[model samples]
Target chain A: MKPSISCKFNRFDLLLSLFVVLAAAALALFFLSHAGGEAGEVSIRDGDNAPYSLTLDAPRRVQLADGHITLVIERGGVYVEYADCPTQDCVRTGKITRTGESIVCLPNRVVVTLEGAGEFDAVTG
Target chain B: MKRTLAALFLTLLLCSCGAPREPESVQFFAMDTLMTITCTEEDLDAVHHAMREIARLDALLSRTREESAVSALNRGETVEDAELAALLTRAAKLCKATGGAFDVTVAPVVSAWGFTADEYRVPTQEEITALLTHVGAGGIGSDGEVTTLAEGVSVDLGGIGKGYASDCAARVFKEENVSGALAALGGNIYAHGTKSDGSPWRVAVRDPFDGSAYVGALSLTDAFAVTSGGYERYFESGGKTYHHIIDPATGYPAESGLASVTVVCGEGLLADALSTALYVMGEAKAIEFYRTFEEPFDMILVTQDGRVVLTEGAAALWDTSVAEHSYQYETINKL
Candidate 1:
């Protein structure tokens, strides 16, 4: 009796299936590790004047300006830093970087937010 | 190949459908006790240290100051300290803002009334009137870092210390990357950010007459709420109750119609000052004062008759159970 094509094909199929299983396992591990270490990003905007400027501080920067006044975003929080406005209340208000936290320069109309960490938790399916 | 693709897609869908992460609850200490912080570990430590620091400041600026820096100032002495300078500056600002309603220089009156460290017997009207002579913030003047007390005037931060503590703790929490936190120091409470549930922090105002029962719970985000209740630090003599929140002008306990006045603001100092200010302003003028401020804030007034009136923004969070037997209050903004 001659060897059937089915038997030859079964041997090849088993090796292919094993390869797919190993690849899936590797991908799943990589996905989980990345998810666990993800950090959040928060954007702070200076809300004044024509072509208002925005300062980002997830990295770092000094004085940034568009037109009317120069604002500064350092470390994580944003501040008026330097302004031509009287009272300097915005500068006195100091830094704010937490979520829902802001140093509004009512005069300049700037709002800064400290972004929350952890986009999603393990218990929220 | 088709079968393999189908299996791969099925696995991917299943993995995606699985549960995500759940946030861990954080805890800490404040309000003169062990307070659980519902925040990160670093934030927890920062808040704890801040509270201790505030308490130290209180000891230095307290109405019952024996060895406090303000006491030294009362004795006509000059001191060089950063905390003292900051507290004095804020104290002066509060005096100006509240029209002397929130005077830190009212320590002599507080002491004469037996609300001080000795907790002595209540004094005669004559004694209170005598001590009032030297008890005004105007007596103290500063040129930048140099603060000089005029004769016998003393400073007390008790009316505002707890609120300041809450402010300090909040400041540290924000600095240390705390997402949201609520610090309650006695009757003074401050909350920041949305909760882990993505809702604003909810705080309950306890009834002045009954310690166990709450009058109502008000919800706020990134605001400090302080209550100046008639029940706080009082003594009864001849069927008359003498409580804290004394009126500076009259040198007597504020005769406001409300049992408690709660003021909410961005920081504890303002909340504290406003609470005292509103209590002294009485209901009619308090409403007027609330509208006068440029910044956005809210207030809840619990009258002596058990009626509740909340500012426009805080009216939405009135929990009927806590405010049982109380009627809803309309805000000036609504009118």
Candidate 2:
């Protein structure tokens, strides 16, 4: 006669397995959310001061270097609206919409860089 | 079974906890450009120290700063700073190595073109000729402690300052025992170590023709790479375009038939100087130089004729999958 075996999971076992599954899922989601380059933010560095970041979800005009520089964020694009620096190279950079692009005003010691996931860590030219 | 499941979950959590933390980045302006240094959060102090070091060098080396040692030398004063003297000596050596293709004594010509003051004017041929008289490595003199310049000659370290600054940052990183770091001082880049994930840092070579795209990317670790291109600084006047990389030979923009040149080596200063020198050397001569130079260095040359040429060493780490398909690619092996 063939013997038949039956296995049963208790309430504690089922709860424990479910908890493990949920916890793993939660960890995966957390990592996915915190991955680099997903956040479309604009980072501005002025001299030795602390860097400032702004989300690109809205349009805004930001004055920097005590009104010496005027930065504009419009329609997911960033550009230098006005700069009192002599070179005006910052203003000539035009608008940067993609990640990794930057406008640097050497005289003012201001660098406005677009932060997100870029193809390369740095650009050399 | 329940115990096994619990152990697995615990292991997963521990693995997640052990993963590398986010890097702390410090950005500032120095050497007349934007500089960004990134390292582990625990090594943030080292980054700050590096910044201070770069600032000190800038104060000492800046040509525009009246109190700088360079300014003193430019004023015909024998500046007695050992650091400045050493740098001047090194600059002279590099200028000689490139057969005077790159010279720090081209400062007057650069100023005459209005590039230094941003006045934006095309200097007359006669004016350039006069300025060229002062443009040569021999114009700088040093006695290992004091530095001097010829009567009409001045020096501008703009071509190599950023590279040397990156070298300073690398020195700091090494002293602090930082795990991994990347310092980008304008077009000069020094990769201290691999990324936290153990992968090499990826640096893209900007396309000379297209400001928005890149010609290729290089994976680097513990290396210095510098790219020189006319596209970075230029002006258009009277239907003519003028760039800042003046050929010391001609007192004018280098018309070497090459758009850009990237030099990769172990030393940041060498990489920086060679990039400019090679760009001025053009394609054929640059390749010949690469084959004959005793020091090991890799190079990438983007020519005006839509060709991307890479030295054998550079080709090993180059990734052209994302490069513009319009340009044909070539690799140069030692002949």
Best by lDDT: 2
Q: In angstroms, give how far residue A43 of model 2 lies from its true place.
A: 2.5
Tens-digit per-residue lDDT, A12-63, candidate 2 = 7687777767777777676655554443789888867888898888899999
Off by over 4 Å in 1: A1-125, B1-37, B40-42, B63-66, B118-120
**Residue B287 in model 2: lDDT:** 86
In order, the B-chain TM-scores come to: 0.84, 0.96
Error of 2 at B3 (Å): 4.6
Q: Can you write out model 2's per-residue Cα lDDT over B140-205, one digit (the tens) per residue?
A: 989989888889989999888888888888999999998899899887999999878788989999
Predict model 1's lDDT versus the native.
0.63
How accurately is candidate 2 docked according to DockQ? 0.44
RMSD of candidates 1 onward, in order = 19.1, 3.7
